[model samples]
Target: MGHLFSKRKSRVTEHDKALLQLKTTRDKIHQYQKRSEATVEKDRQLAKKLIRDGKKERALLLLRKKKFIEEQLKKTDGTLDNIEKMIQDIEFSQIEMQVVDSLKIGNESLKQINAMLSIEDVEHILDETQEAVEKQREIDALLSGGLLTEEDETAAEEELDAIIADAIQKRLPEAPTDVENPEVVLPDVPETLPEAEKKAQKEKVAMAAS
Candidate 1:
């Protein structure tokens, strides 16, 4: 993996170096083109001056030279344009390569991380957790086992039932018109609503709001 990664990195670096070289060459071409253009313009002006002074032959010679330089300038322009295009292409390819390399590195890292957590390791941990929960339950059962006798538990249940019965009897509204036993009291019942009722009430409120 390390070797492969290093090879890819080296390739990217080489591509960058090649792009730099291309840009340098392009800049040199541009400089040469500027000088060539200046020479061509100067020659054209000199030819015009010679023609005004009645030196047609000399003027023609200078014109010929200017024409040659103009040709070279045209060729240079073409080369410079090509170099510019090449530079842009190289830059785009370099960016693509960098992105590919980054994704590769990320994928390799994820693979390594996944390797560290093998299926066996995960299963082992789950098994240990289950064992721990079972052991805890056994310990709890052992600790609370003798705290309450069967008879004692039964008596406690009976007492609870009697208390519940008495509470229900007290809560019974004898007769709504029993004036002698008039009471102003809240009901002795659980205040918590059932899940279904709560859901229905929420829906009703939402509908009303809408």
Candidate 2:
């Protein structure tokens, strides 16, 4: 069961098939070139033997054939180079096509997003938000204006003044109450000066009697 599931099916496109055919042809040409090289070397060895045996014409013919095979081998090498270049160009073209397709998709997605969200829509949203804020401001102003009438404000100020005056009165010292009156002593008058005079008269009388 694992083997059955592990056999993953791969998709092969026409491009892949074409590249496979090209590589196969290149491999076949390479193999043929190798065989031709071996044949050329063998023919050269045989031509040397033919020269030693005095068969000059046959050896020259063999050398001519070897030359023709070398020329054909060079042509095959050119074919291989062209095939490789074509394969590389095809692959690079595929990459460029993919890049163009990706850019197209991205451009379409951006267009969709721009279509959904436009400048007008954004401006409308901002206008609504501004209107809402203005309404809220008006509401706040109305409420504040209604709550604080002139009479209420004056009464509140008077009440606050009364509270402040009461606080100040509480901080002052209490007045004195039921206080006693103090006695003030006065100096005596000089109405008793006749006593000194009387003492002097008595002394005079005593001198007369003696």
Best model per TM-score? 1
Where model 2 places Cα greater than 4 Å from the true spot, the runs are 1-17, 52-58, 120-210
Q: How close to the true structure is residue 148 of candidate 1, measured as C-alpha lDDT? A: 74
Per-residue C-alpha lDDT of model 2 across residues 13-124, encoded as one tens digit per residue: 7887888898899889999999999999999999999999999999999999999999999999899999999888878877997698669666777777788898999999
Residue pairs in steric clash, candidate 1? none
| Model 2, residue 114: C-alpha shift (Å) | 2.6
Report lDDT (Cα) of residue 137, candidate 2. 88
Question: Residue 105 of model 2: what lDDT?
Answer: 69
Q: Candidate 1's C-alpha lDDT?
A: 0.78
Taking all chains together, the TM-score of candidate 2 against the true structure is 0.48
Q: Which residue ranges in model 1 land beyond 4 Å of their true spot?
A: 1-13, 118-210
**Model 2: worst 10 consecutive residues (lDDT sum):** 184-193
- For each candidate, what is the lDDT? 0.78, 0.78
